[model samples]
Target: MRISRRLRPRSLRTRLVLIATVLATSAVLVCQAAGLTVMRSWLTDQIDERLTDFRPPSPVYRDVADGNGLDHRARTDDVLPSDYRVFFYGANGRLLSESLGRSDGEPRLPHTAAALKLWNGRPTTVPAETGDGSWRVVADSGSDGMRAVVALPLDTVEGATSKLLWFSLAIGTVVAAAVMVLGSVAVRLGLRPLNRVEDTARRITHGELALSVTETSPDTEVGRLGIAFNTMLDQLRAALHRKDAFERRLRRFMADAGHELRTPLTSIQGFSELLLQQPAMAPLQRNEAHELIARNADRMSRLVDDLLMLAQIGDTPAIRRELVDLLSLAADGVTATALRHPDRDIRLVPLADEDTTPGELDVVEALGDPHQLAQVIGNLLANACTHTPSDTRIEVRVGTVRTGPRAGGTDRAGRTSAAGPMTPGIPASVIEVADDGPGLAADDAHQVFERFYRACHTGAVEAQPGSGLGLAIASTIAEAHGGRLELDTGTGEGCTFRLLVPETTAPKGHTR
Candidate 1:
């Protein structure tokens, strides 16, 4: 088995060439054998026909009957070839007189009754009278009561057949060699594309990830193979790019998280050390230090909680799904924000296309985790309230917008269409939290949903700095529920955050 495997052709081109050569050689050999057989048969038949047609003169027969032997100078000798022989036999099947062909000595003759019977009246092959070679002979009884045998030597026929056999073998050898050589060349040309594929693979192994197969015709086997290879390469490159981006984002997130945690830890450590060293300090100063430490601790705790929540949302699809009313969630967020910042004008407003007033807005319902959606609304409201001045007016609007395949046109608030809905043409619920405040800069706007990203306001002072994870957590939760959190904002024009989720479609005559 090992030897056979080692002897087998390893390359595709070599195997193809070898197979073609073998088939051609086989065909040539079969033709050679067939030609040899037919030629030998035809030559032997001609020799038999000549022996049967030839007849000796009367003198030769008469002399042979009288035991005078054959007449060498008979006129019939000129009509017959020198290789023909005549033998005279008695009635008792005893050889009496004979004529030798060109060969010396007496030729082998069939003298016995059984031999004469077998060779009578038809040509048959038998050993020569000289016991040297074979002859084609016929036996017959003459009218003079004498029996005669005529024979022909087979040397000429065999000699011609031998020459033809040798010629055919020579021709077959040349044909096989030409087939091998030409077949090898044809196979090499046919496999050129495969050779290119091999070279491309070698280069890719050496780290050329951007390379793609260019012979994508789809008309031949090799062309189709090239097309598949190109597709696989494209997908591989895309996956690698995504992996690289994810790694970079993770590294940045780690660094920012460490920095955020370190700040609060440092403040807590400093305040505890102060209390330890100054036990007799003034009550007011000590109380202020305690308050500062508590505030920092609370910020650190909230940051940790937000980080945990983001991780959960990113790593799993285990959100508690239920039908959620976006209008009610927005109203609740407005009430909570108003209590937190009573100086700010925070209200729930109707969208431009809503037929009813703000207080009677439609129940914009969707399928999602209620707690997570509520958190998203609360975070958007809190983000607006924290970033802008106390006099800024914040508006929360809720409505259903067309989404999904064939979804087009603007929403009620004159915004571009979102993605298609859960059920083909059904609309998706959207909650927009808009604030007329000092909006984020163009650069900061893009990275607002990134972990630990905080925008700086130039002309306003915040009542308290946040942990910078509210928007990030909100985005993560929205994605986990198969929804998206999009922001529409510009410098000085204020900011608006849109939360769009797939709406639940109920059966006709039923409400969800």
Candidate 2:
């Protein structure tokens, strides 16, 4: 086991080459063994046939011999080859005459009458009593009470078989070598792409995030693996980028929050210090200082509240979801804004073909946190009123719009919006707060929904003071409700803020 483990290939290419070599060698060996067996059998049969061709002369020729008994040596001249041996016996099982072949070593033939009779003249293999080797022998009895045996040695067959075996070994060795070399080349070429992938991984490990696998063919296993590996790398890179961006945003948000809070805190502290240091000041002066302090404190409180609302909206399950009447929400927002800024002409534009009668509740509905939705609408209206002039006309249009099949749209900045398209043929509730006022510049409009983003130009004479978090809060709330707040504005072209949310139906047996 230890030896085998040590011998096992460590590399894939080596293993593949070794396997191919082993298979090729085994096949060659099997063929060689089978062929050797067949050839050996054929050679042995040829020797046996030659042994059977020996026809001994009858004993009648022995009486006319020059009294040399049976002239057994003459039998080799006509029918027997130099390698054949002949043995003779009398009817009484007595040894008579024996004749040796031309070969130097003498053959061990059957000496007893019973042994000779057992042969029955059929060709067969028998071990030589001389301990030299084996032979193919035939024995038979003649009509004149004479018994004769013929034999031949098997040295030629064995010599030829040995040479053939050596040849087969040489052939098998060459074939195995060829297979190993070619198989190694093929395996190396096949694994080149994987090597590149490994190199890519190494580079990536060292912080090269942009590197990707180049072999992306879908037809081969290696190609498919490369493609999947590239996909995973892409996802990893994207996730890392998102993490970095989030960290940047978080740092900016922290800085902005600290700056926003510091202004009000400083004002409050300065005013309180003034009042405490000058207790003898006039009543009117004292009252004004107290009011300034209270106003800054209130501003700080509102900022904190907006921050908390953003945090809550970020938590997916924290927002309550219920049926909401968008048109009513828009109408209420318009009414409230008009009261706040009577100079600005604010009005809610009803959906086309819809009744505008007083107390009419039928309108486009959506599923969301009604309170949050109301806050979103109120924020939009307040933003419009704050940014626009007194004479600017603010129109709140509430209705349902048909959406496309594929759900996705980019914001003004080409960033993915908080909401995607609704189901095909389905309608989404929309509220557009459009104002004929000084609109924002293109650059400012892109980041208008960002936290603490204050536009310097409203196309109006002057931009109003704001915490700059209202629209950000509104956008977050819209996202929590699976909706989006979109802005369309240009310099001097007026500004339009559209709120789109998926439409929903009320539960059965439920009434608004």
Candidate 3:
């Protein structure tokens, strides 16, 4: 008990050691105590039997002996050897005769209850002790009023008992010691995984979320605890990781905003300084300064507008029970994309004009802000143009889709329109804008969509032209419109960008 309390401050090793010691000690104590009980019973039995046989002959023996002179040596001659003793007396309790031979010099009689009972009763035995240590004595009385008593020296009896006790103590001590050692080792082995969990928990505060238990022995309480603890750690690590990523993204957004504004502010300051320093400069120089100032100011205005749109994307709710023309939206995207990148070639790919082109275009429209949809289209077109070489061709494809086999399954991607995010049988449309530029690398295709990431290896990315906010803004807009943006690596050729939007079946207030 004390050992357990003291172990609290030590390592796992100490606590395990304490547990092992207790179990081993208890096991050995029980075994030893049981052994002692059995031995005591066996020793007592032997002593009782020895005393019974050594008792002197009663009247029946004297009758059988007739004239042979009934003394202890002669009475026991046919039954016991000379190392035993016998004493005889009358029923009146008067001393008769006593005989002893080869008795190891210990007292023949201890004057115990066996002697007194022999003088009174017919037969009995009792424990006796003497100067030599201890003994077992017996007494017998007969109808003829003759009594017999027997006595055995206690030196040998005590010697055997002493040896037995020592043997038991020695064996129990050895076994208990061995168990303590072996049990300590086993306990430590079983608990090593728990120690690892402790260390992992401590490491968590240091920002290492990767620590986790690998494997452990099962079927025990400790093992279950380890499993549960590991599962909790996993959840905590995931939440912490998201929190860290969110904080990092927020800081990066602030820094990018400041940097973008600095360029326009610096230009405005320079133009104002020029005006102040030389108010009468030449017309050419004056015109150049005014152009520079206006361009920088316009850039700043565009930046602020995009930032505010991003802010409102999620908060502004769209009524889903409304309809708009999907194809018209595609046309508007082409014109807007052209205006953004006037130096690039942006074209709309016309599909086979079935009756569905017009009818489906109406149904393919989704319940969302058409202005926001146009913003998404504009962002995608701008992103593609930024990563495409001058004069590179861009194709914008738009059409309606069906879920069932009648309209042919979902698409080549193995995902049917039935499983599409816009709800099955709801006649949605997809805007596929692909560019034939040096396509993005296979590894970077997915990561390039991350906020502020530029495809450095694509060789066509605008490394410094604009804020890296176009793709993120486009993605946000797509999500707000109940749609998703999917990208293809286009390693074999140019990049493929697809926007899938759900169709609404209700009415629409006029939208552009």
| Candidate 1 C-alpha lDDT tens digits along 269-322 | 999999999999899999999999999999999989988888788788546877
Candidate 3: residue 369 lDDT (0-100): 70
Off by more than 4 A, model 3:
1-40, 50-55, 59-132, 144-155, 171-259, 276-295, 308-362, 365-371, 381-396, 400-429, 434-468, 479-483, 487-496, 501-512
In model 1, what are the clashing residue pairs, if there are any? 107-129, 108-128, 108-129, 108-130, 403-420, 403-421, 404-419, 404-420, 404-421
Off by over 4 Å in 2: 1-7, 51-78, 85-133, 136-151, 178-197, 219-222, 269-290, 353-362, 404-425, 459-464, 506-512
lDDT of 2 at 84: 75
Report lDDT (Cα) of residue 350, candidate 2. 48
Whole-model lDDT for model 1 versus the true structure?
A: 0.75
- Local error of candidate 2 at residue 262 (angstroms): 2.6
* Best candidate according to lDDT: 1
TM-score per candidate, chains pooled: 0.81, 0.79, 0.57
The residue-by-residue lDDT of candidate 3 on 1-512, one tens digit each, is 99887756576676667666667667766776677667766776766676665544453347423433444444456555555655555455555544434454433443433346334322333444334354445666554565555555555556666776777677767766776688678877877777777777788768887777654447776677778878898798799899998899889888878988898999999998997899889999999999989988888887887787678765774534345566688888898778866777887763223542432333245666777677667777877787777767898877655533232222443221112344445455567677887776656675665655666534564734666667777777677666666666556477767766665553231111
| Pairs that collide, model 2 | 407-421, 438-458
Q: Which residue pairs of candidate 3 clash?
A: 410-416
RMSD of 1: 4.7
